[model samples]
Target: MISTEQLAGFRYVQDLQDQPAALAATLDSLEASPAPGDMADGIVRGRFRRVVLTGMGSSFHALGPLHLRLIESGIYSLLVETSELVHYLPALVAPDSLLVVVSQSGESVEVIRLLEAAAGTAPVVAVTNTPSSTLARESQFVVETRAGEEATVSTKTYVASLAALEWLGAVLTGAGVPPVLRVFRSACAGMTEYLSGWPAHVESLTRFLEGVDHIFLVGRGRSLASAGTGGLILKEAAHFPAEGMSSAAFRHGPLEMVRPGLLLCVFAGDLPTIGLNRRLAADVSRGGGKVAWIGNDADLDALRVGVSAVEALPLMEILPVQMISLVLAARAGREPGAFVRLAKVTTIE
Candidate 1:
């Protein structure tokens, strides 16, 4: 079993802790960089007709929030899994097209295939932590995340990817980088503050996981990306069964699965979706399922009385799932991050 302490992975969190300063630097550099019209001396944007975002596994799901940002800005972007993008979406490529591919290691098999498929037609932008990586060498434009490194499941790299892509999203739409930088700063501060309260949350959530057999995570917009990625992390770290889907999709059929042994984790995003998420939690609770609401919609205000924004943010939005996974691991007597079969880099085709 992966130990809870081992799962905590102090160095991983420390690396994540160190990311805010690095991310701030990246934002500063990006601000000094030319606008969308100015990238590649303005020649690249003129030839590209569409932006296709591709990756695999967590790398692919990381593109979810960015896709929402692009669509909201009306910049015409597509988020396709790399395998399908290489085989079916080949026709969408042109010299004018922009394909931004993300990989932590810059070595996923599908990412390599997609790069090959986009070879001549679309100019490639590779976002990676490794500058010497294969993807970086092949890309016409490369955005290095500068996350330093990561261990266990992706902590800093994923956050850095979000920060980097969010900046690019703003650039693609001709928006100032400061606003994006502001949000990243807030998120970082929130996450940093959130970790302090983990010990208590871990203790309290054990009861919720006592007999739960299935867990479902739902979100929409940018929250959806976190919800899905969160689900994957819980599965990977705790060796549990977890499902991530859209909030609307929960209503269509999955809501029926709510029962005494089921757990529903919903991420409350901005505005209307927040209300919808609360209602979903209520729905699950009404059906006798255990419901843990994260984000602003959760009723943690009573417990959150003395918490700071940094501490509150992760508890409200990020740490609950981590706590829940920890609880589940304890109940199953499993170690937190005991990887038996999966390797860090997925080399197989």
Candidate 2:
């Protein structure tokens, strides 16, 4: 079994190498494009009472942070799965409403159907890794993710999606984009450096995963997005029943299920929320569950830009989780990214 520390470290480095470049490219593209004013002109100026963000899998989880950002800005934004949006929420949309759809491949059938349903009633904005994909072509506006390619699971693409959506948040709220772009650039640099030692970290984490029956991830805000997506990857790649919940929610209920053989991962985002996450980790540990804290001051300097930048924070933090999933899958003797019962593009109604 690999050590817990090694797995944690490796996952961190993997994110660093990939997320930074994607973020830089995303920001550069946004800067060069037609301003949000031109793209959102008629919709924002003349209409649009509500904004709905829709997607599937990791793409769906990416909406968590932006949903909070929108609500904080007084925009009544809704986060719904594309399948659900198509079958049930069609009536909620109209010509004035804005539908933001995120799909890494841009060719998912449900996304395609959702676009068709929103054809004339609302404006569709597609955020996808494939610029030439069908969904991108069908949407009124498209934001391309520069996450390049993935070997199996959604690694860089997930972070790229988050960075892209955060920029959209700034644009929609009329906040200046320059500041966010600068932060993103710095963050990318930090992410790259943080991931440099990923192999070593993965080696450490393997030990804890050796005989674990389940894994639980907890975080809040943007971290919650990470927690959910990370848990999903752990399940898909490692063939484990991994679960994620907001730290607060776990306290309210899920904490009861933790056990000695269980692995619990807590993502501590910023200073304000770190304590809460850490406390949850402690609770899990006290209950005899194996636990780990992904980010702290000791590792923060190693991931910050300049020396290491704050912009790269998310990338650095997210990488370790991805690596853990990858390593666990390899150790479990399973082919990574093999969807046994699910299709790459979910078309179910």
Candidate 3:
């Protein structure tokens, strides 16, 4: 229940609020038409020498989970941006490579160029919202996200791409994915719950973030999807400067940048790395930096949004950051994601 007073005509805020339905619809569309064609079967069987995942912006970030999952499931995968895949790494688009491309519009310039570069060599599995766009038309296997229309600055499409990629991961890994899908169902409600508390979440996080001269979003594993996208959208939607990097990377040099007005949101992600992230929070605090732990383990009630399972963590993790962007926009007296110069779709590489 976000009021208009807070949005400042920020259409992307509506896009963010549309996520619950968008996710449900995308999941339903995926379930209703769950077939990946013969090329995908070969890739799933590890017949391909390499599997390359390519996209740009949030679409690229959404592939983080699937890329890691494919590697863990014994499928050799490389996560490369479409721009890189098309020009510099065209050799990687070999006959034995399975290319998985994600784009909500499916007509972005990079996607078109990647399709041209990989045309006859690789078997492509395209996950996109548009059924007739270049990516969909050129792909051998299409996994349509069905996120519908997004105005500006990706929100629904980002979540929907993540959902579509999750489904793709399940199909390739042959894992028991009923619980995964169930967790997706829970994610919609989790987001709805968070959005319902939007007024409070915005005010509190804004106040928490007040006087924060710089922002750093850090996370590990799948949470990196949120961390990376969160940091990007804060800049796009709020025009605020933020950096999203790995928790380990932050410790190397950026840790010294921690001073008053510097706020770090550390994702206490999965079990294997959660402890390490928590320790980083402790170390940041000891170094006089403000640290906010995110995840079920976060000590603050405001930061902890209940996620149903680890499968749902990526979807859950971005909600608070979305709130931050809205508040930042309102504070700056601008519409969130109103794009003063940037276009919704990247028409040029």
**Model 1 residue 342 lDDT?**
77
Ranking by lDDT: 3, 2, 1
What stretches of model 3 exceed 4 Å from their correct place?
1-9, 44-46, 299-301
Per-model lDDT: 0.69, 0.73, 0.85
Expressed as tens digits, the lDDT of each residue in 173-232 for candidate 3 is 777556667889888888887777776777777678777767899999999998899999
Model 1, CA-based lDDT: 0.69
Report residue 22 deviation for candidate 1 (angstroms).
Answer: 6.7
- Relative to the true structure, candidate 2 reaches a TM of 0.87
Backbone steric clashes in candidate 1, count:
11
Give the per-residue lDDT of model 2 (tens digit) for 1-349. Answer: 4444443444333443566677777778877765556444543564777889999888998888778877887787899998888888887567767899999888888888887788777888888989989888888888888777754567778888887887888788777878877777777666666566556555666654667777888877777787888888888767778888888988898888988778877776776777777778877888989876777543323222232333334455666676677667667665555667766556655
Backbone atom clashes (below 3 Å) for every candidate: 11, 31, 0
Candidate 2 lDDT (Cα, 0 to 1): 0.73
Better of 2 and 3 by TM-score: 3
lDDT of 2 at 220: 79
Q: Estimate each model's TM-score.
A: 0.86, 0.87, 0.95
Q: Kindly give the stretch of ten consecutive residues in candidate 1 with the minimal lDDT sum.
A: 302-311
